[model samples]
Structures are given as structure tokens and as C-alpha cells.
Target chain A: MKVAVIQFPGSNCDQDALYSLREDIGVAAEYVWHDSTSLVGFNAVFVPGGFTYGDYLRCGAMAATAPVMDEVRRFAREGRPVVGVCNGFQILCESHILPGALMQNVNQKFLGQDCYLKAINRTSPWTERVEGVVRIPIAHMEGRYVADAETLARLEGDGLVAFRYVSPTGELSEEWNPNGATNAIAGIVNDKGNVLGMMPHPERATRKLLGCDDGLAIMSAFRLLPVN
Target chain B: MVTVRVFVNLKPSLLDSAGRTVTGALHKLQFDEVADARIGKTITLQMEKFDEERVKAMCAKLLANPVIEDYSYEVLN
Candidate 1:
């Protein structure tokens, strides 16, 4: 399977994602510049992390309106897998393809550490077959997930929540939440379950040398899924 | 020429950590009268035409995220 990893200005993790997907996960992946307007050949799209547009006007705000996003939105509408990590998550939220907004961390600090994430939804293409808790590193200043009460209720009722911050023992608790995300949400999928937005850097954890390879399961799930 | 000034802020239901931090500093400086603080951004745009509706659309579409923030604009010529 082929994947497209979008590269916006100030995106630092594009290579990491490409390496993880292409080299480690054994899928054909290429970098798609943000200015490009098409995503025709790729079956899957990955939005990697970084301070897109220098995090100006709000993180991922400007990058969300890039020319290529229109095509990304269309690609998502086709029911293909689209995963956004870190600032990519912010961009997805800014693009309104995903629900809610990421706010400044409740602690008002940038957190760069490994955290445990519970797989809340095992049916989505990104999380299917992934078992139990996974450890991933998150590096961001604004990763707090929030939405209005009604939207939050709908997300919960629909089982759209893809992941949640949890203790190592797999218990959900505010203390284990690094960013104070609502409901300890670490990631979520759209109503259709094709689009996923999460703050953690799964690509960075795809290799044993990186201290963990649990993230590889996520990428593998996307690679293994049949093209739509 | 027309200029539009837009103000965008997080909704009251959301916690404003930056604003709270600023309020804490203010209280420490003996500004105890400050009971609550909210932080927001003001974006100034220069335009050739002044249309209230267009400006509102601009704010709604790109200048502010409707999910967590509210926005207002003033047109000046």
C-alpha cells in the first residue's frame, strides 16, 4: 500500500513518519508538500507533527487552510484512512474534519514525555487489532482536547473516542493526563471513523531503538487495511 | 481603505490558563480587585471594502474556531 505524508512549512516530523512507514512498516510512502492540490495515487494520508506555519495565529490554523487540505478533506470523505499526529491533530481540528479544538495545556507548560494511552475504540482502521495500553511520546504546548457538552456526549455515545490517557495499569485518571484533555482523550476519530486526530507522536515510537515500538501496530493497521 | 479589528477568545466554559496565570501575577502585585481574567487575540485586517457580513464570515471561517472560541469585529475606515 502507498501512503502520502503531508509536509507543511515548519513540519519537522515528516521524515520521521516517512521513515517509519516506508522503511519500518514496509509501505510505499511519499511526502506531499502542502502547496500541492492533489492526493490521487495514495490510498492513505498521514499528517505528521511540527509547528506548522510556525504555530502562528494558533497552532495548525494557517496550515489547515493550505491548498492541499481541500484534497485531503475529499480524500477523507472517500472513507480512506487519514491520521494526524501532534500538530497534524491541530490541523485536523482546524480543518473541522475532526471534532473539538486543542487548547493550551491546563498546566500552561509544554510537555515532552512518554505517556500511556488506552485504546478506547478498537474498530477504527488506525486502532483495529491494537491491544491494551500503548506508550507514546507527546511533545506539544497545546494538546488539551475540548468540545462543547453536546459534542462531547455525542462522541462518547458514538464510540468515536479512539484513545484516552490512562495510568500504566490502564486506569483513567486526571493525574495520568499530561495535557488535561477532556475525558483524558488522547485521540479521536470522526463520526465515520476514517479520520483520526491525536497529539502523541506514534511515528517516533516505531522502532526499538526509540525505546518502544508499540506505535508500529498503529501504522501497520493502516498499511494492512485494504484500499478503499 | 477599510480596516477590521477582530477579537477572538475562548468560550467561558473553557479554562484560560494564560489568563489565569496573568491574574495570579496581578493579585500578587496587590491588584486584588481582579476577580477573573480571560485571554484572547485581536486580529487587524486591512481591506478595500467594508462589509459587516463579509467580515463576520472571515472571522467565522478562519479567524476563530467556532468550537471553542467566540469572535467579534469592528470595521473602521
Candidate 2:
């Protein structure tokens, strides 16, 4: 199976994403430029985290308007797998491929630390291998996920709640929340479950050098999808 | 000419932690009268004619996120 990692002008994690997927996970992944229109043959797409367009105006606001987002939308509609990390997540939300907008952190400060995440729904192919609670590293100044009441209810009702934050002990309670969001939501899937967006940088936690083991479990979720 | 104004905000279900913190700070400063606080954005664009669908598409495509935020544009002529 081929995995395509999108490379925007300012994407800093392309190498790391590529390294983790090809070297660590032993997957055949290629880098796709942000201006490309076609996304054929690739089974999955990864919008890695970084400051796209110098983060001018808003975080992902500029990148969302990029020329290639049209294909991103089409791929999402075709029930293909897409994951957005950090600023990538912002772009996806900006493109309306996922639910909710990521707002500034509650403290208005850039947070760079390891945190825990609970797999709220494992039904999706993206979460099938990850069970219970795991840890991932989150690094961003704007990572708060926000949505309206009715829309939030719809997401929950549709089993779109993918991953939430909790204590390292795996206690699925509100007290374990590291970030500021309802029920400490760290990640969520779109209505179709083909798109996954999360604040935590799984690419950052893939190696022991990064000081976390949570990323392995998260990436393993991709293996459940038949490699083609 | 038509002027379109777009309003964007976080959904009610999504927590406005930043707004909450600001409200908390205000309360700490003895501003208890502040019932609630929320943060959002607004933009205005001038166009030749008003098309609700096109305007909605613009908002959906760039101005605002339909998933986390709902936006409505007022047409002024």
C-alpha cells in the first residue's frame, strides 16, 4: 500500500512523517506537493503539521485556500483515508473536511508536551487497532476544537467521536483532560469516518527518542485497512 | 452593489476555553455581571450582485467552517 504525505511550503514534519511511515512502519509512502491536483493510487493521505503560509491571517486559514485542497475534498468524499495533524488539522477543518474549528489554546500559549488520548470509538478502520487510552504528544498554540451544540450532538450520535484525552492511567473521566475541550476531545473522525483530525502529533511520538509510546498504537490503526 | 458580511464562531458544543478563561479573569476582577463570553470573527466583502448560494459557498470554502462554525451573511445594497 502506498501512503501519500502532502508537503506544503511550510510543512516541517514531512521528513518525520516520511521517516516514521517508511522506516518505522515499513510502508511505501511518497511526498505529494501541495499544488498537485491528482491523488490517484495512494491509499491514504497525511497532512503533516507545520506553519503553512507563515501562519498569516489565521493558523490554517491561508493553507485551506491552497490550490490542492480541491483534491483533498474529493479524496475525503471518496471514502479514502485522510489524517490531519496540528496545522494540518486546522486546514482540514478550514476546508470543511472535518467537524469543528481549532481555536487558540485556553491559555493563549503554545503548548508542547506529551498528553494522553483515549480512543472513544474503535469502529472506524483508523481506530480498530488502538483500544482504550493511549498517550500522544501535542504541540501547538491553537489546538482547541470547537463546534455548535446541534452539530456536536450529531457527531456524537453518529459515532464520530474518535479519540479523547484522559489521564495516563486510562481513566476515562473529565479530570484527566489536558487540553480545554468538552470531555477532553483530542481527535475526531468526520461523519463518514474516513477522515481523522487530531491535535496531538503522532509523528512526534513515533520513536522512543521522542519520549512516547502512544504513537505506535495510533499508527497501527492504519494496518487494519487492507494494504493494496 | 451588494455587501456581504460574514460572522464566524465556535459551535456551542465545542468549548470556548479561551472565552471562558477571559470571563473567569473578568469575574476575578469583580466583573460578575458578565453573563458569558464567546470569541468569533467577522468579514465583509463587496460584490456586484448577491447570490445566497455563491455567498454560502464562499463562506463554506474560505470564510467560515461549517463543521465547527455556522456563518450567515447579510446582503446590503
Candidate 3:
């Protein structure tokens, strides 16, 4: 599968994402600048996490209006798969590509560690290859996901809830959540379930060097399912 | 004159971890009157020349994020 990882100014993790996907996962990946207008024939587009625009005007706010985001939105609407990790998730939220905005961590600290995630919608294209519950590393300060009651209800009812916080034993729990929340929702897919925005860095945890292989299952989703 | 009011907030489905932290802090401080606290920002900008379409463009393009934050403005001529 052809994968394109977007690189914007101040995007520090683009190489990490590219190396992991290309060398580690054996996926065809290229680093695309944020100014590009067309994604061309790429099968999947990966928005890597980083401090886009130095997180100056609200994390992903400035990066959302980038030239490439136009194409990103178009591809997303066309039912192509797009995966956003960390800051990429922030950009997606800012661009209105996905619901919910990432806020400051509940602990008010930059959290960098391996996190456990309970697979909420295993039937979706992003999680179809993953098992019941999985472990992945999440590294970010603005990782908390939030939304209103009506929208949250709609997302829950529509099966857009893709992953939730889980205990070490792989049991879902709201209290043990890294970020404070009622459902401990870690990640969510769009209404179409093709565009997925996740806080956890599956690319970071894709190899043993990163201390886990759980990301393989998540990244493998690209290979398992054809782009919708 | 035109006054634009922009309300910025976390989207309904995303998590507000910072909001929960502030609430917890209030409880720790023994503030019982506070039930829940969600942090948000409201900005009021006054323009000498009022153009609804231009103001809306500014709001949609720069002032607010339509996805996570909803913004509305009124013109006082």
C-alpha cells in the first residue's frame, strides 16, 4: 500500500512515522510537505504527530488551514482512509475533519508512556485487524479528547468510538484513564469510520525498540483493508 | 460598528482533561459551590466597518474553528 506522511513546519515526528512505516512495517511511505495540493495515487495518508506551527495558536489551529489540508479533507470525504496521531489528531480537529478537540492533559503534564487501549469498534477498517484490547504508547501534552453531550451520544450510538482507556489487565475503565473523562475514549473514527484520529502513537510503538508490538496490528489495518 | 463574539471550546466528543483538572482543583480548595467547570475563551472584537460576510469569513477562516468552536456575531450600526 502507498502511504504518505505529511510534514508541516515544526513537524518533528514526520521522520519517525515515515521510518517506522517504511522500514519497520515494510509499507511504501513518503514524506509529503504540507504545501502539496494533491495526494495523487496514495492509498493511505498518515498525519504524523508533532508541534505543528509550534503549537502557537492553539495546537493544530494554524496547521489546519495549510494548503495540503484541502486535499486531506477532499480525500477524507471521498471515503479514503486517513490516520491522525497526536498532533495530527489536533490538526484533524482544527480542520473539522473529525469531531472533538484535544485539550491539555488532565494531569497538566506532558505524558509520555505506554498506554493500554480497549478496542471499542473492532469492526471498523482501522481496527478490523486488531484484537479485543491492545497496548500502545501515547506521548503528548494535549491528548485529552472532549465533546458535548449530544455529539458524544451521537458518536457513541453511531459506533464511532474506536478505542477507550483500559487497565493493565485490558479491562475498560473510566477512572484509570490517563486523561480525565467519563468514557475514557482514547480515539475515534469519523462518521464514515474511514478517517481515524488517535492519540496513541501506533508508529512509535510499532517495533520492539519502542518496547511493544501492539502498534503492528493497528498499522496493519492499512494492509488488511482496502482504502474505502 | 460590528462586534464579533467568538466562543472557543473542545468539540463535544473529544475529552477535556484540563477542565476536569480545574474542577478537581476547585474541590481541593474547598469550593463547594462549584459543580463543574469547563474552561473556554470568549473574544469580543469591535470593527469600525461592519460587513457580515467579511466578519463571517474572518470567523470561519481565523477567529474560530467551526468544528470544535462555534462563533456568532452581531453588527451594531
Which candidate wins on lDDT?
1
Per-residue CA lDDT of model 1 for A170-228, tens digit only, reads: 99899999999999999999988889899998899889998999898787866788876
Candidate 2 or 1, higher DockQ:
1
Q: What number of backbone clashes does candidate 3 have, counting pairs of residues 3 or more apart or in separate chains?
A: 10
Off by over 4 Å in 3: B1-48, B66-77
For residue A22, model 1's alpha carbon misses the true position, in angstroms, by: 1.1
The number of clashing residue pairs in model 2 is 3
Model 2 regions lying over 4 Å from their true place: A173-175, B1-57, B66-77
Show model 1 residue runs off by greater than 4 Å: none
Pairs with backbone N, CA or C atoms under 3 Å apart (clashes), candidate 1? none
Better model by TM-score, 1 or 3? Answer: 1
Whole-structure CA lDDT of model 3? 0.82
lDDT of 3 by residue, A149-187 (tens): 777898899888888889988876765688664478888
TM-score of 1: 0.98
Interface RMSD for each predicted structure: 0.6, 2.8, 2.9
Q: Is candidate 1 or candidate 2 better by lDDT?
A: 1
lDDT (Cα) of model 1 = 0.91
RMSD of each: 1.0, 3.5, 3.8
First chain TM-score for all predictions? 0.98, 0.93, 0.95
